[model samples]
Target: MTTQENVRRVLDWAVAEIGVPGIVAEVKDGDQTWFASAGVADIRTGAARRPGEYLHTGSSGKAFTAAVLLSLEAEGRLSLEDTVNTRLPGVLGTNGYDGDKITIRHLLSNTGGLFPTGLAPEVSHRYATRSGILEHRFDTFTTEELLRIAVSQPPVGAPGDRFEYANGGFHLAGAIIEKITGNTYAEEVDRRVIQPLGLTHTRVRPLDDTGYPAPHPRAYSTLFLKDGADPSTVTPENWESLMEEPGQPPLDVTEFNTSLAWSAGNVVSTTGDMIHFVDSMVTGSLLPPAQHRQLWTTVSTEGSYWMPHARYGLGMFEFDKQATGGRTLRGVGGSLWGTWFLAVGTPDDQHTIAVHTNTEWKSWDLMFKLIEAEFGVAIGA
Candidate 1:
């Protein structure tokens, strides 16, 4: 099939098999570009997903956070080797691990040895104030809050012992940015990254309810009761309508308050903007060549089978080789609420493929297939 036909085929299969309510995809290689969308944005209002719609980039936000930190380092405001305690004292308290032993590098590499808190609580003391909550729009967070959460929990292992993915580290990084710049995390992000990139559609808005712009898709999730009750049997129409309620309780639906997971997962963007950000990073427009290289260096494995060479570097996931068929692609994946995103590309090829969906069920597989078909190479499961 021709490339256009191939793209269409992939879109059809995605909607049919994955129950993807909406998708915004962008494929680019050198001078070539292809954009497409399928299904309705709001199944309730019969609103179709349109080109240029924005979706929450999720953990993909980490790449931007890392870039901001690297930029600060370039300015000589801080160094990655600085210990957490030096910048934010009494924050990590002495109860759990030695906060002084955990360096900024540990946090960035996910080797800080901080234990997991499962998923963060949807509401917290950190965002108790209206101003604090709104600050999430620009990535506001405090180092003290983040370190307390990290050190209060028992160690997953000794520092640098092994890779244990933790959002606490990134949250700490966000706080460090605030301390060094004397600016809120959001302001620093805008000055250092978003505004520089001319990314108009992207913002850190966590409490805003303006919804996505025109042609936007309303996000949905499959709700299952925590009490072991049967999953909600609501139809798609009802699901679409229910999303209109703001400040809805977490128990009511699959949507999550990502503000609680700031720095690590609190980013929102579009496929187009994401591709632009990656292109800039790989081409050395964002960071110095050396710093960019540092960002790609891997620290730990994501899992054994799926990601053999998968390592967390800075705020990004680096896949050295695919666990499936080894068609090389490197980028990031993020999940929030019921949404999922995958952005993959190779340095030598300049070919980037990004996919964002409004639902989480089997979303990763759907993104992998689209990448494989577009790049003409098979990827593992």
Candidate 2:
């Protein structure tokens, strides 16, 4: 029952009220599919946003990663119960951690206790601010470098103790995928998920900075910079002040290397592909019955500093949107340097909505508003 008019209002509000530069959304309800956008894709050119524009979907790619690994389990190539040490011997037994104690299940469910090293204050100070992102934006990072950075930090919690978001866990998953299949994580994802679903617009973990496709909106970063201060440490009051100051346009962060995120957060895809991908997942077309159940098996994310009030599943989440008529929706969501994305579908596979903004900041409510508009649900907005 999603109409174009409803979507248009939400998109307009996002531009007029939230100032995303541009936003794109796709909603599918049974045989009816609706696509719309508001604001200009390029602030300078004033170009209109298009449905076909490519989106770097960030950790939303985790669903694809989980699907690939779970598909391998369905094929008897692996088991969710397998320990990390059993797969990749010595990669994770560092910094007050025991690799033998962590299971593939724990990693997928966001309970592996791996620290998100990319979010470290020092790392952010060097590469997350407006100017900091420039120095090494084009640098291609190897998996070894990524792992070394991640495990250098102490474990946040014991494996299976709590729901703590960890991007490094997915890298561990990617390493296991390569070890078991003798194929790159990207290759396995291609053969198992992308090729099967005919998702032509999706590519995971780009190899270089040159891979960012054209005909896409220029990404803008709201990570404000001032003197030598890191943007990651910006408090709410100061961030508000920075936003209210005039003549401050967001930085164009479109050209950075996606390999900095590797298999964890770097899947560039489109809304069209995402809507279809989530639909396929809900219909159990991606994994066998046993494996699909494993994928949907829930672990409470109560104390999670990331995505609170949701239940973590295998690389995805089930959100009980009290603001959206208390309906429970299943999907994967993620944010990158300059994007906030949410791709959700009804549990029965009757409807799906995929939406994302060009900037990572100032997107909290705008995202749920997109869904509220399409599904005619109430927003606490």
Candidate 3:
């Protein structure tokens, strides 16, 4: 069977079994590329999802922020060993936070012990619960506000102490990028990665911008309801309640202002663009030798907010023989509202898979199924 057909089978199963609104999977192996989708983009119109449509990529944008910083480092604009205080002194040291103790490398790998801002349960619950998203959906927030929210909470650990997945680290990274380059995080990313690579379809959603570019799927999200009240109890009328269930028909989040996610999770792109981006990242074509090697240097994340045996590098995850049986997979995975996207490939850049689902409620089986179907490699067996 063709790879497209095979991926369609999996997408079909994901829709039927997981009850998601839609799914899109793109595979790039050598010279061949496959794009497959199942389910609908709009529930009211029952519009079919198309291949070229962009979706909210959530924290996958973390990789972009990391790349921009690494590029700056390559030009001797900064150093990974530079402590946060050296560049943006006193910005993150308030409330028991010591910026001097946290290195850029620690921040990139999420070991800087800074409290998480966007990923904090309280921030997540605030939007998904009592207020729902309507109140804040259009609100624009500054990156420094996000940093303040994170530092208000006690530090999670000492610098380089643990492998917690914190969006605050990337936010800090973005802030530093701004300090050094005098350009916005999105601007740097565009100049360094998107424009250079000719990724015409990739874009960083602006803080004040709502809605997507033309020919994009409407994103849906239930925010952090997944860990709350039972799904069956959730009804359309009370969907905005704090006790609201997790997976009621997802609300249309397509046009929500992405500023709340800042430099951490506000990228939109197509599978084709993602494939090329992943290929570039895995091959070190966009990074200098020193930065490239630093990108792969990792620390154990087995007990962090990731799968078993997973290791974290600067801004991506590394799954090697232990995590992926015998092969290696390095990439980023992100979810926001009701959408999810994951892009991973081997160290040698021989194979790559980029998959997106319109609903974030799918189970872990979806990942293993995709890997097994695409690469014939059983992960977590």
Candidate 4:
């Protein structure tokens, strides 16, 4: 079968067997491009998933946050070496973290020992359960509120101690942007990157915007959290077992306020825009020489709570030749209620793949298969 056919098969398999509500993906290979989707956008109406629809880019926006800050550094407006103490004054010291020791770069790279909100039961309760999301879907959180939750917990470790996914660290980044430029992170991103690159479908989701633009698929989540449930234990494999009732339909969670996500997520985009935008990121087409080098400067994720096989850059990650498929694909990924997105490509921009399912989370087998199909990457190669 053709590679496109194989990719389509995987998408179909994801929907039919893996229980994703819908899926859309696009592959950009130099002058040629391919797009396809499977399953239903609106399960009730059987509407089709399409390529141009807006997608929730969860933590994928973290990359853009880093890019904008790096742009500032390029202009000598700020330095990545600046400490949290240096930038924000008194934010990190209270939570057993020493702001004096933590650099802005540590926040971007998630090595700052910041508290991971997902590890909090309260946070997991609200975002990972049907009942909780239904009740709190319209909730709005200020930047301060997010930061408060972040530091409420003790530090995960000392600064630069190891890799741990810290969502709130990027919110601190947004604060730094505001402190330096007198502009919100979103505004800086729009003024500097999105408009300049002509990324038509990319928009920074504001805190108050609870709905997606037109052509968005209804996102669903199979979150059936039982009482006293440890949210950390809930994975795709053990999902059904945790449900109140077996074989329940995934809950629709398309509309959600993104205020809490802010700099970490809060970006809505299309697959085309994602690959285009990420292409600029990995290729360093938009950064100066020094900042670009800093952008890709690597950190080991071996001790990370997420993506341990990957090596993290400022806001991106790379699976080097020693990683699973022995080919380097550097990019960012994000997961939220009802959506999981991955926009990655070869370091040289030879092939870019953006894929997502309008369902909570999965094994990402389909994403990897799509990449291999598009690039003709043999297993273990």
The candidate that wins on TM-score is 4
Across 242-264, the per-residue lDDT of candidate 1 in tens digits comes to 32233222221223355655677
The CA lDDT at 327 in model 1 is 51
Indicate whether candidate 3 or candidate 4 has the larger lDDT.
4
**Clashing pairs for predicted structure model 1, backbone only:** 137-204, 138-186, 324-380
Residue 259 of model 1 has an lDDT of 60
Better of 1 and 4 by TM-score: 4
Give the Cα RMSD of candidate 4: 2.5
In the range 26-138, model 2's lDDT, one tens digit per residue, is 88889988788888888999998898888888888888889999999998989999999999899886789898899999888889887765666545666645566778677
Question: What's the candidate order when arranged by decreasing TM-score?
Answer: 4, 2, 3, 1
**Total clashing residue pairs per candidate?**
3, 0, 3, 0
| lDDT, candidates in the order shown | 0.67, 0.78, 0.78, 0.82
Tens-digit lDDT track of model 4 for 1-381: 988898888888887887888898898888899999898899989999887999898899999899899998988888888998898998876758788998999999999988677656557767666777889889988888877777877887888888888888998999999989998778999988899888999989987898898989998877567666667676435755765554677787777786778898889999999988888887878788788889888888875557646789998988755755666678889988788898888767557889888876677566567667777764344
By summed lDDT, the worst window of 10 consecutive residues in model 2 runs over 236-245
Q: List candidate 2 segments past 4 Å from native.
A: 1-3, 230-247, 321-326, 379-381
Candidate 3 residues lying further than 4 Å off, grouped into runs, are 1-4, 119-122, 224-247
Q: What CA root-mean-square deviation does each model show from the true structure?
A: 7.0, 2.8, 4.3, 2.5
Question: What C-alpha lDDT does candidate 3 achieve relative to the native structure?
Answer: 0.78
lDDT of 3 by residue, 67-94 (tens): 9999998899999989999998888768
**Clash pairs, model 3 backbone:** 221-337, 221-338, 338-360
